[model samples]
Target: MAKFSVVVVFLLLSPFIDGLRFLVVGGTGRVGGSAGAYLCRLSRAEGYDPSDVTLILGGRSSSSYEASKARISSKLIALGLAVPSIEFLMVDLDTPIVPLTATIESCSPTILIHTAGPFQQRTDPNLLKSAIALNIPYVDVCDEPSLCSKSKALSSTVPAIVGAGIWPGTSAIMATEAVHHLRKFENSGDISFPCDDETIDLSFYTAGTGNAGATIVSATFLLLCQKALTFSNGKKAEIEPWIGSRSVDFGGDVQTKTVRLLDNPDVFTLQSSLSSPNISSRFATSPELWNLLFGAMKTSIPKFILEDKNLMQRLAVFSLPVIRFVDSFVGATNAMRVDVSSKSGNSVTFRVIHDDLEECVGLATASFAYEVLKGMDAGIYYPSDLGEEERKGILERVKKEAVLWDFETSYDK
Candidate 1:
């Protein structure tokens, strides 16, 4: 059988399930769409009945419903999987919580997956607050540090998971696991592999990723306009975005990309949650021009423009033309590398690469959603907070869709 046939066969033989409803905000968009698809597949794999697992695609308008439905239908047919139950919902986050609340109340989904975000300038957690009020499990692919902090504050009252996307989500998990593995070196007979103190370094390379639309572009602009927060030398310090740089080889010389520091939430979140004092996250993208342009803007643009949220977002909107053009040629291959080093000199590195950024991101989010649905002692939690067993379970699912690299290398990077 061909590779595609094998995948189809696996889907056919997978477990079936019944009675689960997922309301995906921005379901018509990239991240949400990928997530909804993967969640359905994974749910089926876990024995959920396709007919029973309802997916509600919540968008601001129902205009795109037909096109979105068609795309999903095509994908399902290609995979030889039955088309699951799906619904279209019109939702606007701009409205008051009362209306949104009523909307969600009517849908009565088991869980709400909040993926619609530019998150950069957003400080209000109304949507999350609504989830709390509704008493439902909530997850978001939020990358903004301030919003994460704000959402986390409500943990005592509600079950919410923040930064549940690929970078901050799965990347954080990989970092935590690396720490665990490096610590084991202390028991190894080899003294050279000693483990005591450690550092966590995360690097990512995305190719015009996040097909979610202009929100992703705006989010990128927002991060670029802000200072990157990194934990190093037992302190959290803000550094200029797109400054620190390093070249990372993405296995077998497929590509060696230059990654630069960005305002990734995982750096600080992991530092505060984990024992590692030194934690940093850096990112770059294919079609290096985008990085060049961003770097140039950081230095050349007026601080006033960068500081103004609306202005930055507008800039992002304007830059979309060029970004989309470049993205067309760059191709969507997303890769990440996480390194954990102990003070005693032992370290472990884990890397994962995916062919599609949207798919990887969606799958990553879905994996976390799976755990949350399976019943996590919810309050606010990041991937770093997961227990070994839970983390392993999520990883097992993620590894199926990603290229995993866990190996030793010379201490020199």
Candidate 2:
């Protein structure tokens, strides 16, 4: 299963150069490819030589790996950046545990980044577990609650960051900033903002799949079948996904879009970390017809079919032709808005907009990976779990990649 070229060369040469090695699982996919490329670029920017940074793209298909490598090389060339040495490892998530561990061990990565997902159907965090067993620092862009929970359970054994992507990752960081802002304002004045009555609302919008891969589309379909986790008045509740529709103003060119409640892991983590009892995550995609199509799928499609990962993946792949056609006109803009408010009528709003979802997800995940590489305590953590300074650092790093990054505050007497 060890299919990497120059593995021995990397192992023999890496220690002498004080280099950084990243093993990105699902490295050929949209999110993983973007992250891998960003990591190389970031490493170079941080003073590592192009030869000093190594990227091992772990995936099952050599063709995909080749394509991803070419894409990354082209991007680096276009940006006038030196391309790091990249290798491919034949690794498959579906393989048995022992083999998978062996494959990952063969690379001896400094950090492991797991981005391979349609994480909705996975009942276990096998990749995270493998990283833990190997004692490799880990980061993942997981957006699934059960897998995140499973990863969290093993956090004490290893240093890991889960749900470290655009929405769940940066979005959580935004929520934390909002909470901190509100708390600071409260502490500075005589305002009494009770934690129990505070509310956190997350609204997200993307246009035409944001030029993402089928896995993301499949994940969305799977989410449509599940119950959205929300907190109301300090109590947790599960409601039907894609139902409670609301219009959100993303500001700038994104304008106002209609978003519906979606079962995102951020709500759960934010509620716990920020101690905000009322939290909900909502999402929408363009060009309006897509929203209607998703709503119809959520309500009209059978539960079993929607829950079928294979079926969903097939359906997503089948629909990509049409989706790409629509995407051409709609563009690939993505935005997220986090609103934090207290019963006392004080509130903070944070918004992040990116012209490309794939690139933003990569940058966000890379920021987390960058922090983890710098060193953190051994434990699993959500983006909100990061300390104030750490959160600020990640946000600052991501800000450069964002089309819009800003926050506003309002107080009512």
TM-score of each: 0.88, 0.93
Per-residue accuracy of model 2 over 233-286 as CA lDDT, tens digit each: 889899999988898999989989999999999988877566677999999999
**lDDT computed for candidate 1:** 0.77
Model 2 misplacement above 4 A? 1-18, 155-157, 187-196
How many residue pairs clash in each candidate at the backbone level?
A: 9, 0
* Candidate 2 lDDT score at position 175: 90
The residue-by-residue lDDT of candidate 1 on 160-204, one tens digit each, is 678888887888888777766665555453322324556788899
Predicted structure with the largest TM-score when compared to the true one: 2
Model 1 spans with C-alpha error above 4 angstroms: 1-18, 156-158, 187-197, 210-212, 307-322, 409-413
